[model samples]
Target chain A: MEPLTLDEKIRILTESARYDVSCSSSGSSRSNRKGGIGNAAASGICHSWSADGRCVSLLKILLTNHCIYDCAYCLNRRSNDIRRVALTPDEVAELTINFYRRNYIEGLFLSTGVVRTPDYTMELLIETVRKLREEHRFNGYIHLKLVPGADPLLVERAGRLVDRVSINLELPTRESLALLAPDKSREAILLPMRQVSGLITARRDEGRRAPPFVPAGQSTQVIIGASPESDLRIMTISEQLYQRMGLKRVYYSAYVPVTGDTRLPALNSLPLLLREHRLYQADWLLRFYGFTAYELLEADAPNLDPELDPKTGWALRHRQLFPVEVNRAEYEVLLRVPGIGVRSAKRIVRSRRVQRLRLEELARLGVVMKRARYFLTADGMTSGEADLSSERLKALLLPEKKKRSGPEQLSLFPTNDSDLSALTGEL
Target chain B: MAIWRYDGSFTGFLTLCAALLSQGEEPEEIISAEPLQNDLFRTIISVASDENRGEKMLAAIASRISPDSCRLLWQAFLSEAPGVELLLWRYLSFGRTTGVKCDRFLAHPAVGPVHRLANSVGQEAHRLMGIIRFQETAGGQWYALVEPAYQVLELIAPHFAARCSDMNWLIHDRRRSLAVAWNKQEWRLTRFDAQGVPPLSADEKAWSTIWRGYFAAIAIPERANLRLQQQHLPHRFRKYLTELEKPPRR
Candidate 1:
């Protein structure tokens, strides 16, 4: 067999990296220094979107596809019969710079399979970013994946050079981790995450004059549906990670079957994309909407409602919270309304200070009144539907099926229609 | 009724706005002179572009309204939307009379249209930041072409300048015949002419092919939704994107 060329290496490596879906390039403010090649935007930029509707923000690729352990769900597990290749540190650095020059990507997302040993792979990953930053003077957004159980010194060094770092807690529970990946331990993953979190806080405590250390902060990915954890358990774990470890994001990658192992879901099993989308919505509510995990889910109804959004479902479950007048509600109260997002809630609060808001003016303030109309009142008038049952309101809010003549006309505003659903991970 | 006309530049519009406010005249319409159309029963006042008047208008708005509102006015001017001149005129006049409190009144009749128009322009510029693709030319410079609905070259230039500071690149807005060129250190905006595709080096061609291949390989087969793809990356941006371009026939 012929050895893989640079092109083949990228094709295989990127194919493997595509499954771990943390493509955000924002939240870091790495500015361009004198003689440096690039800078990071505080609100990260997306360079492209793939056919799958996932964001292609970074040049996501792996250092190698060869692994020492066989994770049952991973495509690049050791037992899988697939082409294996690795790029040298210089090669990876050069590829990133060249791609950046052509504006194909914002920066590099360098994750690797366990090759030789965890420390060995960690050193190689660190070397690639170091060469890009110090040798080539490239200062773009670099998201380095931490090799579990690697030295904390190397992880700290990595934090200094790259804008963000992540370690994948692929499964929610330790029992699931033990069942699927015998080589990887729950402790191995959390130890590095804790270290990175502490380092980020320490650097932040030092005033603005101190250099940034992982300015974008640390994030981790958990595989949904591959393990048997319910949405309630998943959100609980995510909330804990956010509060305890100070994670920036907990990405939910709907488990796409890549191997035929008996321990894993059957190859014919569908990817739980809808479930993943619901989890992300709940996650957003947790992070921004001032909603707690228990508020969104309970032990009796552990799973998210597939037909309605998590917010709407929560509104239905708690009926007494509705009918909050838009004009009189506080900022937090307005945020709890079904239709109002964080932006619209802020806008509603701001606009009402000048004059009382009218129902007709809600759309101008960025409120998605389609869902909010049922939950709130404008001035003294109800949204024209008074004291409706929760079941009737839920029926109205559910997305209508097409009438079979033809698919409905696509919206001219890309952000309002299908693209927004994909971008926000909203169902 | 009086109709005011001026050069289509932002400064010219500001000057026209200043003249309207100082004269205590309420114009029926504020139109740019380049595409000037005659209005029956209205006196057309041709206002010259005055730098001092423009500066005064900007300063007054910044002092009275919030700096953020002033930015919104600037962005609205760049939108080139029909009747935006009149919209900004009304917004500024309203802001002047109402003081700093006017900025928060998003639903105000004079302010809402200008805010929406400015928001659309900002959204277009943000979209182009992601969809604008560059191809390496034989001369060692990276070139990209965009045809945004708004005059977004000024808005997007600073972003590319900071992100690709070391490399020389040119982003041409073919619809407006304008281009922004960044030469390692500083960037400048100049008029540009449309030309044929420039020749590419062998390595660039190979990398482009590999990129397209990676793009195709990564998409999940079960979740192929062209409607969603078109929604995120509209049809207008595909002409110059190398990965979206069809490969030449063998």
Candidate 2:
């Protein structure tokens, strides 16, 4: 085959790499050095959003599509005869610089399928990042992926170079991993995660002398729907990743079937976008809203409610927590209200410090009265239909389904992703 | 009742505030003295822009109320929304008594409009920081065009300045006829004219083609949600986005 041009390499690599959904460029405050070309914004910037509604924060592409392990659910599996290509370290660095120059991307997100061995793939990724940072003097945000079984030494070196690093814990359970991705072991995945976590903490303790170790911290992805693990299991894993591993984020990607394998789920099972969306909501509740996996779901009730959000679902289940008095409730209690978010909760606490919050005032402060009015009281007054039964309230709170008509009208103010907008605090 | 008119500058509005507060006269209306906005019934007092008086009023707000309140007022002023001057005046007046915690009084009628205006301007500025796209010129200068709802060039210039400190760039606000020019060191806001597409670099076409291709290739076809895409990148913004532009025929 003729050598692929840079354009061809970019298209193929980006197509293969889009499924690994961890595209955040936030959390790092790396500033531009003398003669450096860029800096990292503490709140990540999205240059453009793709058609799937995902923010294109970084230039996400693979270093190589060549692989040894054939993960059954993966697009780049060795068994699949897809077009294969690889870019040199210099080529990747030049692409990043040119894209950054045109304001097309914030930085580079470099991931790869194992080229020869885990060690070789790790070396390829680290070299591309090092060339971008050291040779090109690029101070932009870079998120590098750690090959699952790569040597710990290379992982440490990668941790020190990039702004953020990650390794995808592809499945939630050991049985699922064994059945689907037999080449990847549970220990091999967690090793780099634990090592990077320890290094980040130890470096923080070592202070200014040790330099920064993944200043944006580490994150990982867990594929949903491919395996039989329930939403509860996914939330439990994410919670552990946050608390135990000290991971900044745990992304949940809904399984998009690419290859046919006997072990894989049926082809008719469409991508579980709604389930993935609920997991994202539950993940936010765990990280910011002071909720636990146990509180969100029980072993029997493993799946998140398809019709309602995780917060509203929890609020309905725990009826005793309703009618939270906004004027007198604690900040944590206020956060549990169905419609209130982190920002509105803080605003309620702040505004109440000056004066008692009334029902009208809560709306002005950005409280979603549609859902919150059923869950809270303001200034000793309950809103309309506040005393209704849980079933009735759930019926009222369920989002009114839009009729799919001749042509979908684009709303000037989109409410479809209000829950998501609140999570990212973007748009 | 009397209506106050200013020369349509932030300092001019501040001077109007200084004049009204000194005289203890209630303002029935505060409008900009541009495009001939006038009233036949009320007495019109045209206030001129005074640098010293404006600075003094700014210092007073910072010291008496809060520096954040000053920032809020400036951002609201940049919005160019109708009746924002009166809203700022009312907010400042309320802040005098409420003190530094005036901003936290979100429920107060006087404070809410100013807060919303400032918040809108700030949000638009942040959004434009990401939406603005640059293409390299033949002379190695990077150029972009923006037509934001608010005059956000001054608000967003510093961000690009810090990120692209080593490169020369120009971000032109075609709607406001203003631009920010950075020459590898400092940036300055200057008047700019709308012209046709400038001569681009030789490699610009290929890079942009790849960008558009990458954009198209990155979206998951199974999860194509045009509603969500329109939510983030609205139709208004697609006009200048290079990725959304149609490629030339072979």
Candidate 3:
């Protein structure tokens, strides 16, 4: 075979890594050293947006696409006859520095397929990152994928060198992992996570002289709609990961069929993007809105409500809590309102301190009044015409919602109520 | 009622603000003098741009009101939104009495517009920090062109300066005719005209081609949502982004 050009190698590697779906360059605030090439902003910056509407934050690519394990849902599974290419450590470092100088990327997101052994692949990843950091003196954000079943010392070293680390628990349940990825196990994945979490916690109180151990902490991704797991089960696992593993984020990647495997479910339609979006909303609720997974979901209603967001669903189910006075409601209670988000909830609490909030004033403070109008009272006034019945309110919310054929398209200038909600994702 | 006007520079704006504060009288309007803004019913007072007074005004706001409020006032001035000067004057007057607590009063008519304008400038500066792409020039310097809606060239310069301190670079604001140049150590914002740009360095095209390929390959065809893409990276920005650029005709 003719040697693959750098362009061919980059295209192949990026395509293989695209399905992983964790592109955030935030959380780590690594400032540039005296002669370094880049820095990480705490808020993160999106260099470009892809056609799929995902933000292109980093140069997300793989070291190689050659795997020993055959994960049925993975594009780089061992059984697939795809083109396999791997860049050397120097190549990776040079590419990253050039891209950083050009301001084309925040940093590099380096993930890989297992080459020969987990430890060996981890060493390759570590060497590439070390070259970028030590050899090139690059001070940019790097999110390295912790190879499952890698040696503990290798994982520790990789965690120390990078800003963020993640190991994908591609499927939620052990049974699903066994069915789809027989080579991977629940224990092999959790060991490194537990190790990194301990290291991250231990390094917190250490002196500034100690090298930061994954300053952005760890995040993981789960394949939504891949297995038969329900939203309740997924959220419950996410909650556990947050509490137990001290994870920063748990991404939900909707399964798009990459292989004609007998184990994989064939979807004739689009990937479950709406489900993924709702899960992100539910995740935000858990992290920011102070909602429990069980509170957002019940045993009978295991999956999230397709029509309404998890917050709005929770608000509708608990209608007796409605019509909370905006002027006097606690910040936490204000967060529970259907249309109010963390920002608006804080705004409501702050602005009301200066002046009594009226029904119209709530909109000026960034409240999505279309949904909040049904649930909040401002200055002892309620929407006179809006019917408070749950059924009627649900109907009112449904009219502006277009029939779901695909992912919700957000309009920049949102003229209607549903468009506004889609724009803010407040609910 | 008095309508005061000054040159559109930040120093000029601050000089106008300083004059307004000393007068202890409310102006009906504050506006830029260039392009000659006229109001038929009000008297217009033209204030000269005094640099020392502008510096004094900034220091006073930083000490008396709050450094945070001072930053907000600067950002609002950068926004160059129509009639923002009046909003800032009201905010400054309110802050003078309210002290550091002026920003906390978010719902106040005097503070809200200034705060919102500052937020708009901040948001645009942050966005431009990402979307500003640099092409390698013939002398091995990185050059980027931007036409941001707000006067945000200075706001984003510190970021690129810190990140790319080892390299010489220039970021030209096409709309405002200003450029921020960094000479591997220090950076300065200077007046510039877009006569033309230097030729591309060798390998620049090759690297860009590879980048465009990666960008195209990274997007999933199944999840193609052009509208959502447009929402985040607006059409105006797409014109300058390398990855978003249309390849030259064969």
lDDT of each: 0.83, 0.86, 0.86
After superposing candidate 2, which stretches have Cα over 4 Å from the reference?
A208-210, A267-271, A405-427, B35-38
What is the lDDT for B140 in model 2? 91
User: Which lDDT tens digits does candidate 2 get at residues B9-28?
Assistant: 88988888989889987798
Q: Among all windows of ten consecutive residues in candidate 2 chain A, which has the lowest summed lDDT?
A: A418-427
Measured against the true two-chain complex, the DockQ scores of the candidates, in the order shown, are 0.57, 0.62, 0.61
Give candidate 1 misplaced runs (Cα > 4 Å). A267-271, A402-427, B34-40
For every candidate, the chain B TM-score is 0.94, 0.96, 0.95
Cα lDDT, model 3, residue A363: 83
- Model 3: which docking level applies? medium
Q: Please give the lDDT score for candidate 1.
A: 0.83
lDDT of 2 by residue, A1-427 (tens): 8887778889999999999888788888888988999999888788888887777879999988888998999999999999989888898999899989888898999999897789988998999999988989999999999999999999999988899999999999999998889899999999999999999989889987667889999999888888898898889889999999999998877788887787878743333666777788788899999999999999999999978888899889988867888999999999999888887898888889898989999988889888898888898899768678888888898888767753232322336333332323221
How does the DockQ of candidate 1 come out? Answer: 0.57
- TM-score of chain A, model number 2: 0.95
Interface quality of candidate 3 as DockQ: 0.61
iRMS, model 1 (angstroms)? 3.5
